[model samples]
Target: MPEVWERGADDEFAGRADDGSYDATARVVDARGVDDEQRVEAALRPKRLADFPGQPRVRDQLSLVLEAARRRDAVPDHILLSGPPGLGKTTLAMIVAAELERPIRVTSGPAIQHAGDLAAILSSLAEGEVLFLDEIHRMARPAEEMLYLAMEDFRVDVIVGKGPGATAIPLELPPFTVVGATTRAGLLPAPLRDRFGFTGHLDFYSSDDLAAILVRSARLLGVEALDDGIAEIAGRSRGTPRIANRLLRRVRDWSQVHGRGVVDLEAAHEALALFDVDVRGLDRLDRGVLELLCTRFGGGPVGLSTLAVAVGEEPDTVETVAEPYLVREGFMVRTPRGRAATALAWQHLGLTAPMDAPGAGAPQLPLDGEGRFS
Candidate 1:
């Protein structure tokens, strides 16, 4: 479970700090910390384009841009990678760093809440460094505005002091490249999106691509995966490389515990079953979230807040983490009113959809892969 912090929940939000505690900014910076688990994940992250798997379209397009930029000995154009989490946005960011032959300075939108915070980071970047800003749409508007000018002109106007004496300090930044990543592209302002020279949407991987990923992971972890086992995992990976890798990791644990030398069908099935991840790619959390919305919420015209309470998940996790897969899998719909479980969702859960299920007076949104959606 993620820790709960009260940064925005008190009088500390008031600048006076009458409680005898430090200011928010100081506490904020001091509180930002990561642990060994995250460190291991980062170290294990694929560092180059070739090392990264899935999203063939993005990989091919990015390769062309990289080759062209490499020839000119210049910084590559600003790029935006929009996709679901754990689908290799960060991996792609690292790949951009490696391909451009430059260092990467990683940060998140909420991490730099103020313009000065962004200014300090941006001005300090070396030329050609890849500044990967993840969840960029969540950035504060003021900093985002500053980002526009910095991106367009490689400069920023640092404002100092109060109304009468305020002055815009002109600061030049290095011609570094910005690799903005977001799971929700709709939330990004047009001006911000338009500044990027290239935008890549990382779609879900095909089963074949996921199979290749399993092969790669097998090699990396020194496990011999049977062909059938790989195929099974691939089909049940939620069409995401991250899930594929995670399933592989879990299977590895199974092999070790059971004294198996290779990851065969039995080992794979046992491991996946233990994790409650079904062959159709539905995890317990995914199923529970859908079940609650469909049954408990009555095919939902239910508000997200109410649904989140029913399912015990962060709303963002439902929206970004789980729903994309559910939505893509023809399991749900996001309507103007609220989220609704589709006919396919009912079928998957071994139940029947409501009378209004798709085309039967069901309200359908303009979503991708709509045919099987209901």
Candidate 2:
């Protein structure tokens, strides 16, 4: 949760830069078209629950919950959505409001820095409004306490004065739903976690699901795309809809400039190669980690700090941004000792595993006579 405050029209709020102004959202600021190439991700976001693909379990469960609440003509219960970034937690929050036909107030946990800030937002809520709190785990401790009381009792106590003269004033709140999203749900206290009536965890999308998402997004963006092209992009999307959509736009650029103005297999491959994303969906940093582990450290039991230093990245960035996916994809493994690259990782990087490597007996992908993975 970063404290990026920029005001927008009415209830809308945008993130700001250090100088207190809206900064253009881009992957890089270089003049090499990276800035323009970074599409506005929100444009492809699904507005309704049905339009959102993947996470079948969560979607089905959430649909029933919302329908039941609608039938009762009441506000839905508080919900906690837990998952990694770009998996559509925020989209689901908005869908909750859409399904209930209620207006939603958008704010993040970092915005509520004090008990008073939480009080103001809670107290000002209209009955049945949906309040979305992104990155809920990063909320201030004092605010967390106030939130517990508010959620359970629909009331908050305002403390006035100082020292022994402190007086508590009770304020009643209208019944409303708090839709909280967090990437690190384990960090939430048990007391706060128990307050949510329903909890949903989002998981990464499958390649088939990603393909379907890309097709739908192509229609929304009015880009002509072939099925093979969609599949290619989906295969390299790292199982995230956000990345899939972003790659689609870049592919569209290559199609228009280098070839026919349609996203075909050739356009997809050319655009992806230009971006340096490998066939297994591993980007430069991802391959860098694997390469260093296999080559520099002899298939490593290397420490995370040493590995991060070798890659010129912060330990936290490597842990949160890269390690989870690598571990999930079976390219890397974490042990009590340290980090180690799997035999699959070595093969993926087009290198042979050393005889002494950990998990040297791991199964290898079937290969052609020319040494290409089949």
Candidate 3:
């Protein structure tokens, strides 16, 4: 008989602080969600893969995997989901379980600090259960190694007692599927990465896809939203469904408080303006980084640490959160030396890029053997 254990709640949405004030500068990569946000996101999430809006490629691929496993009357192969934050990785994990008609156990890498921690979870899983591991790249080394064995062989070797007198006890686990989610797939070791049979990389949502997501979310939230208002919010959603839904809620609040309880283009613009999100989806921290690079640094290559300090943010925050979107939008560039603002960045800030600016001149030489853009 499998032992019962508590399943950790999935963290998805970003929300207000303890003081009830929304944090516009929170790291998009962080998965910790406030209670209100978590509840609302759970309700907003699509229960099955067919209902999932965006990422058509991933949705189709996952459908095949689950359907084949169902026909075979066996657990599906271990699945890996990799991409930037807010791209529905967690939601996909839930959909996998739903499609398979199996119970899911949710936990994160940081929660499993020791091999025993992982062994316990594996031993407790019911046959054909889905174990959803969030942030799999951050799992402890020992735990990760244990996971490699468990994922491949459906067993864990539990070590008892101290180093010298320790005895290895092989614990056979029920056949189950592991669905791992990570924002940094590259950080995963080759051995562990190879254990997963199917890997799906989710891309940022298109504006049209985002608009479609907003329409669904608006209906679900019972917000009376106009088409133009939904389009306005989607355009400023930074290619993320999470941000789109969040912005929609903010617009709803603005409409109720300021307008006549109708989410229109005016309400969206006013709410987004109040929240410091510009027309280009650049937020306060994003614009701060651009402004510092173009004006303070003369648009030259500055070290990432220096650029982050200038913007009053952590290097990881600047790199993982703001930099991806900025570079994707062509407003910034990552050079061999460091970070540089592009001409578009300068233009967006209503400034001109100098001739010798990092991106304005000829291409920069590669650092070492790597490409110009590290």
TM-scores for the candidates: 0.80, 0.86, 0.85
List, residue by residue over 1-374, the lDDT tens digit for candidate 1. Answer: 22234455464444434454544443333323456446546655777887777777889999989889999998989999998776889889889989888999999998988988999998899998999999999999999999999999999998889899999999998899999999999999999999999999998888888898888778766788899889878878877888888898788789789847678888889989999998788888789988897788777777777777788988887876778778877688888888888787887788777888643346656543313334
How large an RMSD does model 2 have?
8.0
Cα shift from native, residue 8, model 1 (Å): 38
Candidate 3 lDDT at 351 equals 93
Worst 10 residues of 2 by lDDT: 21-30
Question: Quick one: how many clashes does candidate 1 have?
Answer: 0
Give a tens-digit lDDT track for model 2, residues 233-253.
998888888888889989998
Give the clashing residue pairs of candidate 3, or none. none
lDDT sort, best first: 2, 3, 1
lDDT of 2 at 369: 32
Model 2: pairs clashing at backbone N, Cα or C within 3 Å: none
Query: What count of clashes does model 3 give?
Result: 0
In angstroms, how far off is 185's CA in candidate 2?
Answer: 1.0
Model with the higher TM-score, candidate 1 or 2: 2
